[model samples]
Target: MASTRTTRLDRKQVIDTALRLLNEVGLEGLTLRAIAAELNVKAPALYWHFKDKQALLDEMATEMMRRMGWPSEDQSADWREVITAAMQGLRAHLLRYRDGARVYSGTHFTDTSYAGPMETFLARLTTQGFTPAAAVRGWHTAYSYTIGYLIEEQAMTGRTFDLTARAERLADHPLAAQAGEEMFGDYDAGFDRGLRAVVEGIGATLRAPGAPGKGRGEARA
Candidate 1:
């Protein structure tokens, strides 16, 4: 039997091995058997730590969140700044791994481990005077927007179209054609502008009197 220290090391090794495999083979290729083989361990040993493949995936997602410093200790910033920075950090982290957004989208948040960032976000929003329900809604809105935007941004990168191609395609719409060149010229700026707009809109909604209270009850931990 492995010592407790050895067991912990083995679990970390298995998870790290799985992450590397995920990066190399994409989510579809990640599996317990594959990870065990990569870690030079038996599949049964992995199962000892993870009930099944989904459990492993959940652990992987949780690990990814930890890597990004979710549940941040710093509470110095206002809600808007904190949320925006968190979203931006999420986008950057997703961009770091292939098919990262897909992985994140599929992961469940019912697990408190997976809900750390969200809990922190809602707590901040509620502190800023948002109702619990409003804070939850706002958190979901920002999260959805960030993930959706990142998906679109990643998809755009895979396209072959350049400014000239876009310009020609939009020639019938003269104004659009002119805008295409400038749009393509500074795509990063456009991304930031869109993010800023979303954050500002959410902020405005929170600031409005009677917009909505956090909701009828207290927030869940």
Candidate 2:
């Protein structure tokens, strides 16, 4: 019962179909068979494009990066500004699909399309007095925070919570109730504040005595 259109199926076609199906079925329900059905192809036809579910996910993450566009080539901005913008943009893109953060985490990219932009970003950091290793670490920290935040955020989506009721129920545990209240308030402002702390923490590391460049503007005269 395969459609004639199935014969024209390509990798992009498969990945695109998978992404579309992702929002509908989410990461747990999205399977090669589902994508194949959506594309009007047999499950085997999908295997021809992706060897397995993980392979498809890897490529899907790659496609997500492509859609996210790249950091600007302009290096005039401070490294902290660059990290904030990039992480915030990543959060927005991950919010676009159900389980998007899950799909992106722990998946290897299937292509080198990310390399050029990453190189540019690293170069920007180095010019701002980050050692190559420090630049890599800083980026990883920010990336980890963004991914972790979205994972929790997506998991909580559409779930009705009665924070006040919970707090009253936990009135015996005053600190726990207060913590829960704080955790549920204004995720946007919380994310911004947390990201600022991350950037500032990294900046502190770089400025510590004996650190590379010693200071942001002190990069090897």
Candidate 3:
């Protein structure tokens, strides 16, 4: 049983405090003790609200998802448009904090409210001629792409690595310099172009007869 003092602390309050501390400390430094200190509570008190650090992380990710406006209600938009918008929103949200992608990665959501919205989103895709499996897979691919991109993006921008020194080393290599420019320049445009390519590939799978959820006869004899 939680003690009177522990019970008095709100779960939301603890999670919010952890998020604020996350920006200050990054993931490595975001311990339960740190959060408790931020809230002016004992470590045990937080245990009443969160079983462990991972549990707290799960809730933080859930809150991030909620803020990102997941399951956005763009039912009338094309499936590709829906996917692009979702990935874009996710990238933007994750970039808002230090190590945001790392924090969000691999954490289970404590909230089940997202399930209903996900079901509706999937249903909309099926209604628009996608096989349920294909719809899910396509979205997974896009989600993976977004997360992976942000991980690299955050690493590049969040760190104090000397880009100028590296550029000097590669100055003799014209192609490498140009590649660096393409990679480090205009993140927004690069993400959109990559997302477009991914969406296009997913669209191609829809017409492939052997693709998951497609009819057997749909393939060319």
Best candidate, lDDT-wise?
A: 2
Per-prediction TM-score to the true structure, in the order listed: 0.72, 0.90, 0.83
Between prediction 1 and prediction 3, the one with superior lDDT is 3
Candidate 3 per-residue lDDT, tens place, 1-221, comes to: 54334447888898888889988988899999988877777788889888988999899998887777664575555666677777898898898988899888899998796687678767666766688898898888898998888888887875565556768888999678667656777788888999999988887785344434323233322
Off by over 4 Å in 3: 1-7, 160-167, 171-173, 207-221
Model 1: residue 139 alpha-carbon error in angstroms: 1.6
lDDT per residue as tens, model 2, 117-215: 889888878887788898999998999998998898888888887899999999999999987756777778878988999988888885334444334
Q: Cα deviation of 41 in candidate 2 (Å)? A: 1.3
Model 2 TM-score relative to the real fold: 0.90
Model 1: lowest-lDDT 10 consecutive positions: 212-221
What's the lDDT for candidate 1?
A: 0.70
**Candidate ranking (lDDT, best to worst):** 2, 3, 1
- Candidate 2 clashing pairs? none
Give the Å shift of residue 148 in candidate 1: 1.4
